[model samples]
Target: MKRALYQRLTELYNAYVDTFREADGKLPPMMELKRIHTAHVVANARLIAEGEGFDAETTHACDAAALLHDTGRYEQLKRYNTFRDADSVDHAVFSHDIVKEKGWLDGDPHRESILAAVLYHNRRDLPDGLDALTLAAAQTVRDADKLDIFRVLEHQITTTDWRHNSQAFWNLPTTARPNPVVLDDIRSGRPVAYQDIRSLADFVLIQVGWIRNGLAYATTRRLCAERGHLAFRRDFLHQLTDDPAVDELCQYAELPTQGVS
Candidate 1:
């Protein structure tokens, strides 16, 4: 039963992406980035579900949530030309509205749980009163999203012509000094807001900080350890600044040590 649902959800996701193609039948560069990111999130979600031993039905619901989690990005970019929620709209809310309007999960028995997971996946803090299943699904989506984000940031920071894909850089200046406020947020273990990011370094620091706060699943931590994501960030920050404080902050993230295949 859940397998059938997964198939339908994949079809819906493909159809949705098709609507966003440019006049030449290609996605705009940023839109293309989002398209690929969504695919990775779906794959990561499946992996997380399997790693954590979720039941078949719950796993399928998570797969659905992951596939549709960022559906708002296409419309948000088209309408506002920005992915920063503070500059435009709360993408999680927008994504929820899109899924609800499309009636994507209209008749599924797990519809509300799926929708609730999608709605809160991007939140800094999950709301109170979510049932155990709903909370687990939401956390799975969140971990999947963050895992892909680490990949995105790694590419963005390394590529020479990243400027050509300015939206991926969030249009921030590529200066070396991290914003003090942003650094403080990381050091003090507080959630960093998008609006507070004043430079590219601040953005990178925020990503590193997310290692400490953004994670929700043990599977995610294991994957990060296996992927060497934690090591990559630590080294990336060391290259960015020789400050001992930054090293301490990176150490505080406490990512796993085992290598993932």
Candidate 2:
């Protein structure tokens, strides 16, 4: 019964995504990002449920929660370019509102919990009173989200398109010097300030920094290892150990793997 409803919700979500893409005409780069994120969330939820011994039915609910976790982010990004919860409005709150307004999670036993998870997924901390099921689902989704972000940044850096150039995507300043806080965060294993990033290189370093702290699941860590983020960590080691500024980043195409563990 619940599984069927989750399927319907997924179908609707995909339709909404398609419509959003068509209406926008030439989807933004982040659209690919959202798709990738949703996929990872779903996969991560499946892994978590399987490892935790969830039955087939229970696993389906976790998967549904993961799929819908970021549905609000699509609409939020459509209206605002930045993903910063503070710079614009909080995407999580907006996501909760959008899900309810659209009836995206209606009529499912897991609906309220899923909505709650989505609302707080990107938040600095989780709220109180979440039962074990909902809490696990939300944690899976968050870990999956961060894991994929690491993959995205690793891809961007390896491909040398860190600049995010062209009109379709925002021309992120990728060539500017790194900020002191950015370096400090990299060394201390903390979340980087989005505003402190001066160039694409710094942004890449910041993305890698997240793995050290925000990630929660072993599966996420395994996936990140497979993607070769450890190699990326090497650059941070050099930056923190030898030169904080990483003078002449152009000379180094790939970072060494020192700060990853």
Candidate 3:
């Protein structure tokens, strides 16, 4: 995980994605979006690692993990023409397999940890009993991933018609009422389960749920706040529907998350 090694991985990542872009006249819009997202996630990972004062080796390892975390996405789109895991494969696991098959992590001291982090990055909850370094690496990428996702999700919600981006919105109704289970999860301070979300309004609330309870580091939370991600979410939610639950969840979203203030 030295500086030179990290540079090598960066090159490898870019070249890997470039193959897909080169084959087509231009990358598909969704593919291009993921390419951009991988870069931003890497940047966000570095921000969190440095903000948390990770040592050089650990920080470099984290950055490598971030860069390779989405390795399977290109192939996923090619094979299934959709990003939905329920319809195809778990992209995280698919990413993990690609990393392994390519031997991309070979010779890196933190290779296994990075693989573990990639595999678990999209899980509903990380399993308990992971080693400390592995846990930190996983949590760093997960938070980093979410930090950028707020930006991506906000852009998609605000700029485009959700009707056309059904895959991104779980093909749920754009104006349907939030699911009762989703509302309960918010009121009770639990992460919103993807299975419970039945509408775009519910989908937006899932992001707020991330604000209230999902981010893993205070620095990540601060970055989220500084970016006004949560504020935009609040505005977006009201547009979807007027409900007392939105008001309640908004209050919790404002309360300072526990940990380094």
Candidate 4:
């Protein structure tokens, strides 16, 4: 049953990608970026599920949720020309609606759990009282989603040409300094809200700050270290900021020890 469900999900994902493929056999850069990111999240989700010793059925459900978690991103980019939820619609809600409207999970026995996971994967906080199965699935997707985001951020920071993808920088000025309020939230061990991000430096600080509130599994932390994501972000932040306070915040975040297993 798990194998069959996995196969069905692969087919659905392929069809979705086909929708965005250009007639000339190319996807717009953003579409391709998201498509590839979704693939990584699926792989990361499976790794988390296996590390957690989930049964085949639970693992399959989690994988489905990961694949569909960003289904709304493509549409959001097309409709709003941006990925910022504040500037546009909430992508999570849009994804949940698309899953239902398309009946993507209608016949699955774990449909409710899958949908719930996708809907809450991007939320600031998961609601109270989610059933154990739903919570596990949601948390799995959330961790996997965040793990890959670090990979994306690492790539974006290194590549350095924002012209092709201004949205990736949230259109904040690259020269702008970090907002103190945003820094305070991170210092308090909380994830910074989108509204508080006023500049590229604040954005980077929030990404580093995610280490405090975004992680959901021990295995995810190990994976972040193994993938060199933790070290990359730490180094990138050091290069981007000269303020001693930002350095202290990075230290407080425990930027992962370098060369330590």
Candidate 5:
């Protein structure tokens, strides 16, 4: 992958998302949210790639994947007006389709593996035995994506009430008590699944788990820590409930970055 090609892909992504803008040339809030997010994910990917000492082409591939990872979200919103995969389409798979159909990565040397990263990013598990290049791209984008999402969640909840950010909160019931399954998932060092999230607190708790075990790189852990993502999530949960397990799960986040990939 060439840096020039990556730059072209970035331009293409920007112009594509521009189609979602309203008459005033302002993207709707949700579209703007994702547009900003993709930018930061690319920035975050750059940090991780540099910290991990990736070679030039590998960094190029990872950055391209990061920029294009959410390509389908704009189309998904236009078609269904919802980000919920169950309510509409799986954004990740849709993103892969859009990028492929557009031939954005057509001549890149590592096209297939980069596309695989985009395709499998939202899945619960990646297929085992991926090539080193494919694994690098996939892990970089996933880790970068999750790390920034914690920031986005915290910002939306803090700047506005959950009632106003229904898209972010997914219409979950307001409750102080988190679902036992979500707490148990964290307690056992497992990432919480979407179906398992009950209250808004449960959703935050799942992101907290990402700090502990879900991150694929030590650099990601350090970036998340530096950004205070864990502290915000932990503090939010503490305000919501007196559950002692909140502290227990948070302690895991403080532990040294566990076994970076």
Candidate 6:
């Protein structure tokens, strides 16, 4: 069943790629992002499920859910030309809507939960009362998604051309100082603010902070650590330790970490 599902998924992905290329007259802005990132999502999700000792059936659900999590981004971007979900409209909701409209998910064995997972994966918070299966798939996809963002950003920081598209995401100033949100998040061991991030370094750390908050599976965490982002964790902490603004944020939040050396 898993093998068959995988093959079908590959075919669907191939079609999505063809359609995407036709729409943009080129691949999406990032290099091999959709293809490589989707593969990472599936591979990480499978490792997460296997490490958690999930049944084969659950693993199948997770694999389908992870690969399809961003399935709507292609259509959404083709229409809107931007990846900001809130600005273009919620991509997750758009994904669910498009899947129904196009009947792309019709008759798939894991269709219902895969749709549910894709719909809920990028939410600011998980919905109340999610069933175990749905919740597991959602969390798996979220972790895998964030992990791949870390990889993409890590690559961007080193590659000049990658940084060009990345810097344009929020229009960071070339002369901007370090983003204070980066300092505060590290001090509190939380994720950084999304909107105010203003540099390649800040971008990379925010991606790192996702592990500090979004990770749901031990396998996901272990893989992130193995990727050497664990040290980046300390880099943020070091920023917090020295920055007064970060100390102030801690105090304002009344978090215990605030004001402590």
After superposition, candidate 1 runs with Cα above 4 Å error = 161-168, 171-176, 255-261
lDDT of 3 by residue, 1-261 (tens): 288788888888778887887554578888998988998999999999989998887787789889988889999999999888889999999999998988878888888889999999999889999887788889999999999999998777768777656666768887788898999988777777667888888988988888888888988988998999888988888887887788788777878854323
Candidate 3 worst ten-residue window by lDDT? 252-261
- Candidate 4, residues 14-126, lDDT tens digits: the string is 88878878889888898889899999999999999998888877888899999999899988988899887889998989998998888878789899999999899888889
TM-score for model 4? 0.89
Candidate order by lDDT, decreasing, is: 5, 3, 1, 4, 6, 2
What C-alpha lDDT values do all the predictions have?
A: 0.83, 0.65, 0.86, 0.81, 0.86, 0.67
Q: Write the per-residue lDDT of candidate 2 for residues 155-260, one digit (tens) a residue.
A: 6545654335622224555445557778677666666766676654566566555555555655556566667665565564354334434433322323333222
Give the Å shift of residue 109 in candidate 5: 0.5
Identify the superior model by lDDT, candidate 1 or candidate 4: 1
Against the hidden true structure, what lDDT does model 2 obtain? 0.65
Query: For residues 1-261, could you state the per-residue lDDT of candidate 5 as single tens digits?
Result: 286898798789888988888999999998899999999999999999999999988898799899989999999988999888999999999999999999988888989988999998887778999998899999999999998888788778878776545556877775648989888988787767778887888988888877777889988988988999888888888877888888988887798846356
**Candidate RMSDs in order:** 3.3, 5.6, 2.1, 3.4, 1.8, 5.7
Could you tell me how far off, in angstroms, the CA of residue 216 lies in candidate 6 after the best superposition? 1.0
Q: How many clashes in each structure?
A: 2, 7, 0, 0, 0, 0
Residue runs of model 6 more than 4 Å from their true location after superposition: 22-32, 161-169, 174-182, 189-195, 198-202, 232-261
RMSD of 6: 5.7
Q: On residues 1-261, what C-alpha lDDT tens digit does candidate 6 reach at each position?
A: 677876787687667667767455777665247667888888888888887788877777788888777777777777887777766878788777766676666767667877898898887678889877877878878877887776765565456543245453355543344576675675566646676676654654554445555577767777777886645534543443454543343233332222111
User: Clashing pairs in model 3?
Assistant: none
Worst 10-residue lDDT window, candidate 6? 252-261
For TM-score, the strongest prediction is 5
TM-score of each: 0.89, 0.73, 0.92, 0.89, 0.94, 0.77
